[model samples]
Structure formats: structure tokens, C-alpha cells
Target: MKRLTIAPDERRHIERLVDDVLAEHGHWDPVQFVTQAKTVAESLPLRVRQFFRQIQSEESDVAVLSGLPLSPDLDATPTGWDMAQKTGAGRREEVVLALCSAALGEPFAWGNQQDGRIVHDVCPTPGMERSETSGSSTAPLSLHTEDAFHQCRCDYVALFCLRNPERVGTTVVRADRLDLPAPLSGILAEKRFRHRPDQSHVGPHGHSADVADLDAIMFGPPGSCYLRIDFDDTFAADEDDHAARDAIKELYRHMCDAVERVVLEPGDAIFLDNYRVVHGRDPFEPRYDGKDRWLKRVNLIRDIRRVFLSTGVRSRVIS
Candidate 1:
């Protein structure tokens, strides 16, 4: 849970990196951009290494680097046809990933938004809901992991705020630095509760009845953990596991009480060590007037040895 504020010099370096990548790849050619990005990625210094190491060890760590000096000429939508038809944002994303990979000592893979991609939708939707009568729009979201169901769970999930809600929609993060009560601890440490996969994102393959019974210990190793949480009211455990389920709910409630709420403004990015914290959002009335809170979500799988062609892809654009 330590804070790694970027030193003035280091901040300057990161800005330079961003600018150089933009100028080289953003306006030129895709082939050139990708080639230059790989070249730049190889020369990263030691300070960047230390910075990522700190985050890898303490998943709840945060860094606030201001005065990023973005391109004034850059449009709100950086990857319009002008850019995509020529250079493409795929190369831009790769440049960003390379920067992060240098910082984290892990190869970073992206999620694509193309059709039939292996992207995971971590939010709630209507058809996927268990009951229509819940009728709650702005209820407080509980703390849970992103995709505990996937076998190759994520190592880190980074959310870069392109925009913020006009009203609420605060992000609540539960840090592992806090101690859990005995009853809740026992429940989380036990592999008794079951979780159902969200079918809406799983396509029309019909509901897969595979259930996941997880140990509440939250993580497997000191720094390795997987998140398996869903808000669908239909997902429930059997009668025999009722006590364990109740205990899990109680644990979540208690953790929620101690959460730190952060309202992310534009340009603010939060890197969540998937093993160290649980995150959720507070709902707000969306204006739907083009300004409705839009955030760019990017997930990074840290383990370089495990990268597979079928596992990493982007989420679909919900238009």
C-alpha cells in the first residue's frame, strides 16, 4: 500500500517517452511505429525497473505523476480514421504496453474489441441480471475481483481515466493492508462458495453450468491471486454451503466499510495489483449526452512465459 510518487526527473522521462512514441508512430506508418517502439523499449533504465518492482511487490501501491504534457494538437479521439487507416491504434497501444512492461519487468498483452474475441466483460447488464425487480440504479457496488473464473487470471488491471462522471461514480478500493476479522477470514480461506460465469459476455453458447467453488483466502501466493466475482442475482450456492456464502457476504460488507473511495478525474490512471485489492464502482445517473463517464480500461497479463494467442483480446465496444 505504499505510494510511489514519480520523481520530477522520472516524470520528465515518462513524458518524453510518451511524446517520442506519439511523434514517431502516431503520425508516421504502422510498420515504422512498431519497429521504433520495440527499439525504444529495449533501452529503458533502472529507475523504471525499481518503480515497477515496488508495484509488483505491493499490489496496492499508487503513483501520481502530474504535468504529463499531452499533445495539444491531439484530438479527443486520437485514433480516428486519419490515424487508424495509416498507423493504427494497435501500434499505439503496443507502445504504451512496452512502457508498462519496462516498468513492471513483465511482458504486457492487450485486450481487443473485435468480434468473437476472448475479452471478459467485468460489468453488469440487464439480460444478464438474475431478477428484473431489483430495480436499483444507483446502489453501492460491492468489492470483488475482476474475473476469478478464468484459469489464467490477470496479474494487473490498469484503468486510465479518459473522462469522469459529472456526479458520483466513485471507485472504491479495498486494500489488503487492513486486517480481516476472524469469522470473515475463515470464510474467505475456505473453498466452499460457488460462482457462476456471466452468460451475456459468454455469447449465445447457452448457459454453461460450470460452477466455481473458491477459497476465500483472496490470493494463492504472496503476490499471486485470482478474482472470481459477479453481481448477477441468479448465481447462488447450494443449501449445504449457505453458511460459507453468508460468511463471504459478511466479509465483503466489513471490507466495504473500510474502503478508500477515489473519484478518478480525466488523465488519472489507477493500476490495481490484481492480487492485492478488490475494486467496484458507485453508480451515477448517466447523461448519455456524449459526456457520460467514459474511461479507457486496459488489462495487462504480467507473466511473459504464459502468453497465448487465444487468451488475450480486447472487450467489444458497447455501441
Candidate 2:
């Protein structure tokens, strides 16, 4: 894991950058802002820009940037993402995330998730407490690769914490931390596993027949493996494939043993390399009294052409 805390001067400099963008734009339009974000990010503090550059070149598994600016009069947490969206809560922070995310990669969105918003609101929503989506509070989100079912899945999942009064921890497991035996690793390297879209993409009652894809659990150069698996939705392609099923179970056990928890405070943003780290959240009781944990999430890819090639369009949103 790698982390860089913003210095006092750097924080104020970032505040000025965000203010300038907001003053020029009347309203928050991430779709429009995304195109210019990378160019604007060049104006960020030199130290901050260098930090992100190093992470990109080194392929850091998990990285966190702390002490970004937050509104002094930030609004109370909304009941759900829809409420946050309708109220335009935390617009400034969203801009902050966009600027910083653009430094790392091109920010994108999923058409079927979070209403196709480039930035997504993650908070506890009533009636979804035990569900599998980001709205869940009591149910612990299982550690998994973000958008594992898609070939064009993001390269990084950027999560900026706006409020976490309870200090709920985000669980993470790095691919390098697992100590799998050769037999299990060999099985995982084969293309015998099927990944289904998570509930966030396909609602609780929605079917996964349309988005299931078969791929390897682990792939890449020897001694350095990349991982892609959603424990809750991934399964063996053939129900009779007992070896693949057992390999999945064994991998889960290894991940459980190597799990690490990161508790993010306000003004902190974490970028999880989607291929090298699987991340989830710890279950917490929701107060819903305008103080529930809230975060802004953005999916980023190393290049924008990946999205264009996959969607056959030049837009950032994958439809």
C-alpha cells in the first residue's frame, strides 16, 4: 500500500483549483468536466502530481491521498444515492475527486449502475440495508474486483470519503499477499471460471444471463499475478467442474487470511488497482439521521480508447 498526505500548502492550492473550476462552470456536469479534467490536473501541486505519476508507473496495488479539501458547511448525508443526486450534495468534493482521478486515469461510468452517473454516491439506503449494492449498510460487501464481469472493467476504483462518522473500515486483499500452492495457482490461471455482474449492475431481482463471462482468476507474468473474481457472483463455468470450484474456495480462504482494513477519514481518497487488489466494506449499523457514512466513487481506466473500443463509441459511459 502507498499513501501521500497533502501538505497544508498543497491542500490550499487544490482548493483554489477546485474553486476556479466551479466558478467557471455553472453546474456539475461530470461528463463535460471529464474531458478537461486531465488538462486541468496539470495545475495541481507538483508534489501531488508526482505522487500519482509514481503510483501509475509502479502499478501500486493500493494508494491513498489524504487531506484534500472539503466544504466547511458540507451538507448532511442524504438518505440514499438518489437523494444525494437530486440534491446535488457534495458537488465541490465531486470536482476534487474528478481532478485527482484524472491525474491517475480517465474516469468512466457504467450505464446500468448508479443511473449511469460518472461519479456515484455510496451511502446506506433504507430497504437496501442487507442488499449487495453500495446502498447496503448491515451486509458486508465481499472483496472483489470492480466490474469483474466486463472485459473493459476499470483499471482503478477511486473512492473519496466525504463522511464516515463511525470509522467503518474498507477491506482489501492484495494479489501478492496470497500464498497459494502451485496446484491452486495453476487452476486459477485457467479460463474455467464464470463471472456474473454484481447486484449493482443487475438489481436484486435482475438476471445475470446477459453479462456472464468466462475468464481466469489469475493471469499475468510469473511471480506477479493479476486477479479478477467476485466471490459472490463468480463460479465455475461447468457445475461439474469440482477442481475449479475447490480452487475458488481455496483462493477465498487465502484472501481472508491476508485481508487488510483501511478506515478512511473525511478528505481522504483511496485508489484500488482493480486488477491487483480486491476491496469491500465492513458492515455497520445505519443511523440515517443525516450522519451515515458517505463516499463518492469513480471508475478510472488507464486509457480512454479502451472504452471507445469496447462501446464502439467515443463516450466515457459504457452503455
Candidate 3:
């Protein structure tokens, strides 16, 4: 468990940087905002920058940064996911999120998600409380690797929390924490796992969507096996792969027993190595009365060029 705290001076530096960027850009443009974030990343504390440079994905699955400055009256959490106002950053916390993510790599959005919005709002909605999207608070979200069905899925998922009054728990299951049985490990390392795209990533008007054709749940080098699983989105490609099915059951039991709950406080952000961790949240009542928990989430890619669908200096959703 690695942690980094923004020093008082560093926090002040951030405030000045954000203010300057907003005054220059005059709007929250993803392209320009990300570039500014990268500059802010360079001015961050040395320890934070060093850790991001050298952290082994499998060894340090998640890193938390704390002691950032928050806007006045934290009670003013956004009510919904709409940014129809089109005004620049509502607060500096989002800039912190993007800056921290830029410290690692390029941040990108999903074309089929949130209408290609790079920064996504994570707040419980009235009708979506039981749904499978991030807005759900009543239904426990099953552990999952972000966008497991996509070939160009994010390498890291960064979440910045601005509000969380209920102290609800966020479930995290890391591959580094799992010591699977040989049989289960062997089965999971094969390429027989089935994955369906998360409902949030599917578009209504588009080419035909199909299940991803994948062979393994934990694929990569032998030592650093990359995890790819979403119990809700994953199924057996061959129902008769009893060995694989049995392995899945056993693995689930092990992971459930070893799950960890992370509760983020004000101005706290966590960056998860998506290839090494599966995360979810426990079921909680969302009052939805403007005080519900809210987090700004973004997906990071180590190498955007490898996954980009078009040529452009600006970032975009993978096609």
C-alpha cells in the first residue's frame, strides 16, 4: 500500500497552476486541459512523480494521494452528470484528477460511454440506483476490471472523490493479493474466458455489438499476469469447460474472502492498475438529495498511440 500526500506548498502550487490554466483556456476543453494537467504533473512533489514512474503494476496495485485542497463548502456536490452549462471546470479537484493521471500516461474516453465525455461523473441517480452503471448505489457492484471486453481498455482507472458523507465502502480485489490453486491458475491462464461489454459501453445506434473473444482471464507474462474478469460480464465460451467453470467458482470464493474496502475522504484520489485489480462497491442507500457521494473518474492508458483509432494530437475515445 503506497500513499502520497500533497505538501502545503505543493497544494498552493496546484491552486496557482489551476487558476492560471483556467484563466488562459477560458473553458474546460479536454485537449487543452490535459496538456495543462501534464505541466502540473511536472510540478508535483518528487516522491509522487517517482512512484508513478517506477511502480510495478502487479506489486503496487493501487496508490492513494491525500491532503489536497478542496473548494469551499463541500456540500455543493453536483446533482447530476449533466454539464450542459459548458462552463469551465466547476472546481479544481477535477484538474487534480487529470493532472495526477497525466503523471502516469495519456487519459482517454470511451466512445460508447457518456457520449464520449472524458471525465465521467460518479453519483447515484434516482432511477439508476439498482442498475449496473457507476450511478448505482443500492445494488452492490460486482468486482470487475474496467472495460474488460475492449482490446484497448484502460491500463489504469483514476477516481477523485469530492463527496462521500455516508462512508460507503469501495471493494477492491487485486491479483497481487490472490494466491490461487494451481488448477485454477492454469485454467484462468487459458484463452477460454467469455466477456460481454459492460452495459455502459454499449451504444444504441452503431455497428453490431458482440461478445469479446478472449482466451484467458489472466494473460501476460508468467510472473505478472494481467487480470481480466467481470463476473457479471464474463461467461464460459464453452459451457462444457467444466474445469474452467469450477476454477471460476473457486477463484471467486478466494477473492471474496480477501476483498478490501476503500473509503475515500475529501480531496483523496486513488489510481488503480486496472490490469492487476478488480474493483466494485458495496450496496448503500443513496439519499440522492444533492448530498450523495460524487467522484470524478477517468481512464488512463500508458500508450495511447497503440490503441488510438485515428491520428490526432488530441486524445479521443478508442474506435
lDDT of 1 at 18: 66
Candidate 2 lDDT by residue in tens digits, 1-319: 8999999999999999999999988887999999999999999999889989999988899999999999999988988888878999999999999999999999998887877899999999999999889999999999889988888899999999999999999999999898889999999999999888888888654336645577899998876679999999889999999999999999999999999999999999999999999999999999999878999999999989999998798989887
Question: Which 10 successive residues of model 2 have the least lDDT summed?
Answer: 203-212
> What lDDT is obtained when candidate 1 is compared to the true structure?
0.46
Q: Residue by residue across 53-170, what tens digits does model 1's lDDT show?
A: 6776655444432222233332233222223234332333334444544355333322322222221122222332232111112454545555444444456666544445453444
Writing each residue's lDDT as its tens digit, candidate 3 over 211-250 gives: 7476688877777767999878887788897888887788
Task: Give the clashing residue pairs of candidate 1, or none.
Answer: 111-313, 111-314, 112-313, 112-314, 148-227, 148-228, 188-216, 188-217
Tell me each candidate's TM-score: 0.67, 0.97, 0.92
The per-prediction CA RMSD against the true structure, in angstroms, equals 6.6, 1.5, 2.4
Index of the highest-lDDT prediction: 2
Ordered by TM-score, highest first, the candidates read 2, 3, 1
lDDT of 3 at 91: 51
Candidate 2, residue 87: the lDDT equals 95
Model 3: weakest 10-residue lDDT segment is: 83-92
